[model samples]
Target: MDSAGGTLYLKDEDIKLVINPGSIEEGKKIQISLENIWDKTSDPVLNKFETIVSPTVRCGPPGTVFKKHCILSFPYNAVNEEWWEFTLLVKENFQDEWRRIKLGSDDKDIHFYLHNGQCVVNLIHFTNVTLLGYTINIMKAARRVKFGVFGKHSLNKYQLRVRTWNSESNMEVTEDAKLFGEKLVEMATHIDLLYEDLVVRVQDVNNGWQISEASKTQTFSADDLWTKIPWRVFKFTRSDPPSDVLEATISSSQATNVFQLKISCETRQENIRSKVHFWYFISALTVVVIGLIIAWTFDNFQAFLTSHSGIALFLSGLIVALITYSIMWKLVKSATPAQIVACVFLNMSLYYLGVWMCFGFVHPLTTVNIIIILSVYIIAFLVAVVLFGEIVLKFVPFIGLLGSVIFIKLMS
Candidate 1:
């Protein structure tokens, strides 16, 4: 908290951090990592007598001590009945030994409480926390489990979330979901039904789909060393431990899943882009070709850049080539390597050809003239070889430029 008495609260999903005023020296904003570490399900304490109810939530830099008391929350699942009999476990600085803390009276400074399906802890300092307890199994509690796909799959196929929930009626669950637009109600506290109930062996009707992921590491600065963040695709189920969800994973290695990647871009912007590439290939190639024609004609017919017509042509070529390059970058949809290569070469040839026409001044010793001529031949050769290759569209512009080049040279 700052001197202004503004409440400082940082939260992601369910993990929360609320710093009171003067918790860590006055007026100092410290670096915190609540979302940096990956979620874990196993620990040494569980091997003794405790049953793991939820995946371990990790926060860091280990051994961070707070001057004043601060409030922190941990999300938990009711693995079985008697969920109230949970004991909070704290692991400080990645030590082998773990400390057990019970939920005590709030009158004291260091007590925990259950609120809205999460355990709130007010302590001086921390790193990691886990909930441990056992519950009685009730077979009658089983309900119909349903799954739904969330997020725009076409735009971003790399990573997507598949939400699996258990309930009786679809209509009731959906009507209940409408209350929170971007939040999951599965973790909310209830009067009767507990949120941590697991629906085992939920089958995915959609076959041949995989939940694949690559983790990413965020570097706040070049100096601070941080661990690599691997992409995780966990099945964030509403109820119970991950044991049921883990069994559901098929080809995927982790708890995450992925749909296959396609060859072409699937953005809604593709329709407009498809129409433009054809015209752009033609127009960009023509402008550079026109510039080359003007430049070479000026070089041979008149002193280069001396005449008003020559200067205007040179400026036009430079400006239009620049504009074409700018427009090419604006087309931000996912593109094939072939398309990327073609665009790069087209833009390069544009600026290169714009100025390359001056080789007439130094004697055309198989200079740019021969290069453009060979380019046209190569394009023609590819058209003949591939019959209908993608390059054919991008290279068609070279043919037009070839015509202009030949016409201008002949006239000169």
Candidate 2:
């Protein structure tokens, strides 16, 4: 082996293995026995080998042809007056090609590198050991970078962890945890670079995590979702969410401690439009029936008016019943099954009484006509109830009472 070149050749009886140089620091040659070497597996060290550096290891076992001792060379320029020494343990899962140590006049800087799926530590203690690069993974919208306690449990109190926020689109740098949970605040606080279309940021409070994802086009409201969704954290993985959305409307109201938020994202827009169109179609058909009645009245105007006040009364009552039931069901909770049944009977009975009084009692023409026409107005009101009442009921608690008050106030 060349002494000046920082090379060491290992030999065991008749067999030999050549060790190579790395770029980071100065290399050294050492003499040791293969039998006395650390088993590496049983006393597995942390960051001391390539396979174990990563939390998840996909690699296999170590080879058996290693030399008892070997020489190493430093690829990078050596620092002045520094002596290189071999360490038994190195950082875990390190696969770098070179391994070197920096030494001072009185003290040596501990060098770490992974080899043979193990962390080889040459010394028990050394000073001025600096770690070059470390990494962790994160997801987009993941709000927390917690320390002192790791994962969902506190098992890894002193364990250092680093993770990035991963969105379906991108990933960003995050915190690092370490020794006895010290230096945790520094490790947990992180702000990632903003991306092209999506900008993501995270905050770690004493108790919780907050993540905000904003888009170039728009930002949706995320109020009160903490209670609705089971998770305290949220991650958006897709550039575009996959869901069937028909229609979307945004509205807000206040009740109790929480503000009521209404957002509708329908799976099929056409379906909603079809339902609305059907209602309008029914309304138009009713208008046509009214037109027919008017035409017949014009032909035998006086005779028809005199004889069919009863029919007019019946039609008016039917209309009122439809509208009232529809409105009550949509807007108020008080529109119960019993109330609905009672309302229907009352309206029908009123119609019969109005008609009988118009003919049997020879009531005044204006009184009889007014009663009949009023019944028609009642029916039209019911139709209106069916059209708009249902939509209002979802937002109005105590449905009918609230709806009625609001409607009357608004109308007046």
Candidate 3:
């Protein structure tokens, strides 16, 4: 062989050859020759021979900081029958001189050792290792690395491992690594299914608060995947009403996860018209009962007139004026408090006079007197029903007793 740019010939029986390109300096000429040694009992050494078989390295998803186990397999045919020693080297893409990776139990990350004719390593805490003389922060940008597997018989193979953030396996590795990728895809599919099955519901505990029914019980699907649910505001008339705390729970029929949220509900408005009607009925019933009691107590007018003629004449005239005013108010269709009171008084007074004429003027204990009292009571009840609607008619007896007490106090 010439020291510089020379060609060499090899025989078919040759087992090994070594070339040193660095020894040939620039502008130098040298010739080389080889001679075979014929030893009687010594076997031929094939330490310089290169093995064609390469070791396979399988890793998990790339670009992930999470710890993962990587498998390394060496072909059984490539290994020596007795024993074989090899060194694994790794370096970042932009780095020079691959660093020797230690093989022992003391390593916390990136550990590789032979096990059952294959290399196994846990790259859980693996990071780019800095060269002893270099000062650059290579680990920060080290996403890819070149690994070298070297054997004693000059057998070596260099492979590249690229870090990826996705579950896709870019390297042609072991069957186990492919299965791990499939599992990642399956987990993601399940999460998507659970999200599609989620259901949301909103309830109105207070009827006074007005909320749109369309906003309640909203359903979400995978198409509307949201990290945060949309906020729904309560609407009301006049002013913002008092709020009640509301709870929202989100659960999927197919998932075990449960999420909860809280909402505030504004108070509802009151029905003013209904309230006013209720009070008006009470006032009308009170007036009716008071008028009936006054009429009943003054039925024996002649006896009272004889004792206190001046007072009896004044009260009798006042009662007559009130009855006339009540009749006129009703004809005008005026629904003022005073008008209602007057109408109630007139109706009860007319009933009382009819009863007094039939019963008090004759024998009070007779069957005809009892019949007249019953008929007067029936007529008074009918009048009350017409004036206040049936809601107040049921309380007539109670109202009468209450009004009688008030009338007695006034008379005294």
lDDT values, one for every candidate:
0.43, 0.28, 0.33
Please give the lDDT score at residue 309 for candidate 2: 54
lDDT of 3 at 202: 42
- Tell me model 2's lDDT, rounded to 2 decimals: 0.28
TM-score of 3: 0.17
lDDT tens digits, residues 7-80, model 3? 23224212112223433445554443322212211211112221111221212122223223322223212223
lDDT tens digits, residue span 250-348, model 1: 111112212221121122435435544666556666757565655554544566557554575456445644555455535424443344446545654
RMSD of each: 14.4, 22.6, 34.8
What TM-score goes with each of the models? 0.35, 0.19, 0.17
Evaluate residue 360 in candidate 3 and report its C-alpha lDDT on the 0 to 100 scale: 42
Measured by TM-score, the strongest candidate is 1
Model 2 spans with C-alpha error above 4 angstroms: 1-301, 307-333, 352-412
* Preferred candidate (TM-score higher): 1 or 3: 1
Per-residue lDDT, model 3, residue 197, is: 32
